[model samples]
Target: MSGHRTRKWVRVAGTAQICALLIGMAAGGCARLPYTTQVIHEDRRVVVTLQRETRPVPYSHPVQLRTDELAAALAGFSFREKQRLPLRWFAEEVPPKQIFRSDELQAVVPYLVEGLQKAAPDERVYFQVLAPGMNPAYEKDTTAGWIALREPYLHLTLEHFHAQFPVRKSEQWDLRYPALPPEPKTYLLYFEPGRFWETDPVTGQSAVQLREFLKIAIPASSR
Candidate 1:
């Protein structure tokens, strides 16, 4: 069975010579099949990867991260151009930016963490992470939702969103395609997190759509 599985797996995709040989061997000879280079993006807040043999890690105990620590962990949840490297420009709607601001997070994270520690099984900690607008006093962006205790799978979901030109979006605005929201407005997400989490074959199982302009990682540790 192991050998069968391994044989079914092609370590590296294909080589030019191998492709030509396979093409020559084909019954009807080679024909061009149109392919799209466009990348379909999954906008999600949290992404979870599962391994066959690994056990799921759930948040069961009280977890407290210092403002800086929470800030750092948040970096992974946000899109990082440098990390995407050569693929930087692919299918990006807005310039990559961390959704929540550090100072603003300090305001809510401590309380959220406190809730997490005390939450019972099946209970969730609700939070609204905010970021100051580029103009600080004027712009205040929000990410309001709840997070459950650590589980094998991700559970971060964006429920209701109604705001114009989120602070992070404004900060990342370098004359980007999306015109900034003229005013604060509530908009329904194309995909609801809870429904997407439980349904959708690909996303329901292994794939997660990233949103919040954003989990578990050693990131923005600098902040």
Candidate 2:
């Protein structure tokens, strides 16, 4: 969760440590990281472009991203209100609201994964997730962001997320701006490499990973 998207990225510091989450599962699961030797790959298009590079971003062998899984995960991930309610409370829990939808995820995740592989040591993979405005006359609501692999930790930063003002101009128009889309709280969750890496029982070596975690819950999938 971050403040209204700005030019600044919200950095999650002190996160280079190995993540032990799901270590047992990985040890038995055998899911490997999508890494590549070509070290440089690019996908450029009218709306976006992504490059995945390695060097400054030190990575080992075998780069392959399960773009489908990644997209599904991104499509499912959401932001929810943080307030705690008592068990006796009569009100229902708030639903989780997704930041991106299925259609957008299908179009965006592949490029993002590819770009991460082609990133320059100092750069990040970037893109904007968009939603049409409620009013036809306005610009689309957008969530602008980037993803970077800072060694042990991968960072996803949403720098600018803002909804456009719907304009209705007239002498007798309502005297105020329309309400914009709801924004998310700044939340940065860290899962160590262990969360992504799994040990191969047969090879006695750990297979690296580019991973995603998901929990099943219905979400309001929109901005």
Candidate 3:
């Protein structure tokens, strides 16, 4: 999916409950897919790999990531780019209905926060919650309440952010999913390190000061 198309879906996902239905439909089908998780930590970046296993789906279940383990996996990296790497891996290996339903993956959020706190104690961290389909903006408390009630796949992202960032104000954007190009993209979550004014004194108009820091791009293949 092109970044443009993905954003459009996200806009739609924000309003409609179709994704839940799609997930349900996909889950009802047979043929389980194999997936792998890889976490790479470097000086300024942490790359998490959730890809398909080349081998067949094993009879053994994948282990769930503990909060501390998830945190440790993401430790010492900054998501400065603010892009949700496309979930093409899910599309490639798993059915759409099964896409966001992996408890093993969903379980990583809180622990990832724990690891992030240790990795960058003084720095703020953020994770993207809105998928290809999600409402552009939602009231913080209302969104939180809805997530608690709905307990959708997106709750993984939202719950983690609520635990870590705590701050209510934020800006969201659609960015190309990293790695997968030309077809699929994903949502990016961002953390604000500090507070800034959304209004411009010079123009007496409201604008997002932090938006300048966001990265928006499409892979050459997708373009």
Candidate 4:
């Protein structure tokens, strides 16, 4: 069968078959994807956040760190890892065309679906993407009299994710970062929990309530 045909078949197979496949793999002691979970208690409800680093730099031996002096010299070049909460149902963004057949999705989707269904029973889940050069305002200013056009491939990509996951809603956004050179090359995945508006009695100001937030950074080549 063609590769596309195979993926179509897999999607049609649904979650039950996927769950059974996972169970079989678990029985063989196969390694699953890496994830961390965190639990938060606020508003008298337990909220969990599951996170996984999508573009982890693999460990490599230092070429010049054999001596203590050399190690000290290179210390300034190191970066601190971002801290994330560990919880069940970690979701990561897959590149545009790869979501349907990605090995990572195959490994994690079943668990993600099950966790959300059980933990946040009534909450609407989201799968969102943000791509570069998609700024509506920027495009409007530059194109003059033309409607801002989104990349056709990106539209198909969003549709693919909608069909693949049990997503209550899906969306795409444009990002504007002034400090860094526009990557024009990265895609971001966001998992947003349901939101609510609250008014402060003291200040009389309305603000949005943040339940949970997680993001996955996917590189351009991955798409």
Candidate 5:
């Protein structure tokens, strides 16, 4: 089953590659396909592989970086450039249904925060972004429609927690967690955004998209 699942992705990836080529030709600009290169949680880093023009490009370019650095890099890229990275985090208008419905993944927000605190102790963690909304503010709470959370070490199902939590039309928040030493560790969580719907161009995608989620920033201190 694992091998079949892997192969299925490979085939889907091939199809996406062809689609990229078609779209790139139409746009007359570099077309890129998203792909995963490597994910090292112990190092708190994930690298994505990309390809363009039948040439190998950094799809989801791999980098040795903390969560914040990852988030910043992802947000800074253009939409076209973003296609190169196979990150699920994107600012789409449609809600991520596929992830939420999966039994393999679950959301437990407060629990995640508590666990991180227990493990890291003195570290101050802050959330840069989470569901219902997305913004740059690191301290102000949401009005009523959105929710966001930032912190030191990003726990698994961080998105699931926010999504399942109550919120109005849209929400956004910035949460900070304590800091930890550079010593290596591995954090793992299964993220399932169930039945992905079309992205609303205006909103892009869910407040927490695949690319954005993987870019979990572990800050040194809270602002």
Candidate 6:
């Protein structure tokens, strides 16, 4: 089972690598290629943004979703260390760039379907790939493309939390960093939680447990 998951991850990573090549060629303005590729994980609700290091610009659309609907969906996929949920996701692009070859694209389909079937089989999963906004250099100018592009990010809405609380006067001293030139300092936090699997009501799915992943949504405070 572990081998299967590893293979799936490798395939996804390979797709990303291929897309990177397509982006390079398209941005180069080779009429022969005529297009660039972008990846969108609809279920993850994120569009991978690509850019050159020096010219940092938003070359893609923001990942978005209905917050209300997202919350309800998340509630159904309860986090447990022992559970393994299959997820369905995809890649797409605007201006029609062929980032993936037939074989690569074919490789992705099953991986996604299987993942989704295991994670949220009954739930709807969507995907799209898009080219980002036109770069100034590549605006009307056809020449001067082909540059080193950064690695596209895999945007996943794994999980996040928000905690609200008032700090105590005594604790305020510890929060300040007088030794660090009055600049604010942040400390790392860690959490250990027990996990187990329960049947999901919305999708009627099950997941395998590997490691316990935890996030401290709301931190406890004495103040």
Q: Which parts of model 1 have CA positions greater than 4 angstroms off?
A: 1-67, 79-93, 129-141, 151-155, 160-223
If both were scored by lDDT, which would come out higher, candidate 3 or candidate 4? 3
TM-score of 5: 0.16
RMSD of 1: 21.1
Q: On residues 138-220, what C-alpha lDDT tens digit does candidate 1 reach at each position?
A: 45444554454343333444432323233334222233322344432332222223332333242243212222212323234
lDDT of 2 by residue, 1-223 (tens): 4563421222221121123334656778965432333323233211333334433444321233457645644553444333444731422354445666666777678777776556556455667665565665555555655555443333454544444533333222222223344454453222232355444343333332333332222233521
* Residue runs of model 6 more than 4 Å from their true location after superposition: 1-60, 81-223
Local accuracy of candidate 3 as per-residue lDDT tens digits, 70-166: 3322221122112233744444453222112234234435533443333221122223332221332422211110010010011112222211212
Ranking by TM-score: 2, 1, 3, 4, 6, 5
Looking at model 4, report the run of 10 residues with the lowest lDDT sum: 140-149
Ranking of candidates on lDDT, top first: 2, 1, 3, 5, 6, 4
Please identify which of the two predictions, 3 or 5, would achieve the higher lDDT against the true structure. 3
Encode model 6's per-residue lDDT on 1-223: one tens digit a residue: 6988976876676667668768998998755312323222322212222222232323122323222322222222322112222311121211222223344233333333332232221122232222222442222111011111011211122211111111112221232211121122222111112232322232233321111111122223410
lDDT of the candidates, in the order given = 0.39, 0.45, 0.30, 0.26, 0.28, 0.27
Can you give the TM-score per candidate against the true fold? 0.35, 0.42, 0.18, 0.17, 0.16, 0.16
After superposing candidate 4 on the true structure, give the runs of residues whose Cα lies further than 4 Å from its correct spot.
1-23, 36-50, 54-160, 167-223
Among all windows of 10 consecutive residues in model 2, the one with the lowest summed lDDT is 9-18
Name the lDDT value of residue 162 in candidate 2: 45
Q: Give the TM-score of candidate 6.
A: 0.16
Report the C-alpha displacement of residue 92, candidate 3, in angstroms. Answer: 30
lDDT assessment of candidate 6: 0.27
Can you list the residue pairs that collide in candidate 4? Answer: 36-86, 36-87, 37-86, 37-87, 38-86, 38-87
Q: What is the lDDT of residue 50 in candidate 6?
A: 24
Candidate 4 structure quality by residue, lDDT tens digits, 139-208: 2111000000011100110122211211122121112111222112222222112132333343233322
Better of 1 and 6 by lDDT: 1
TM-score of 4: 0.17
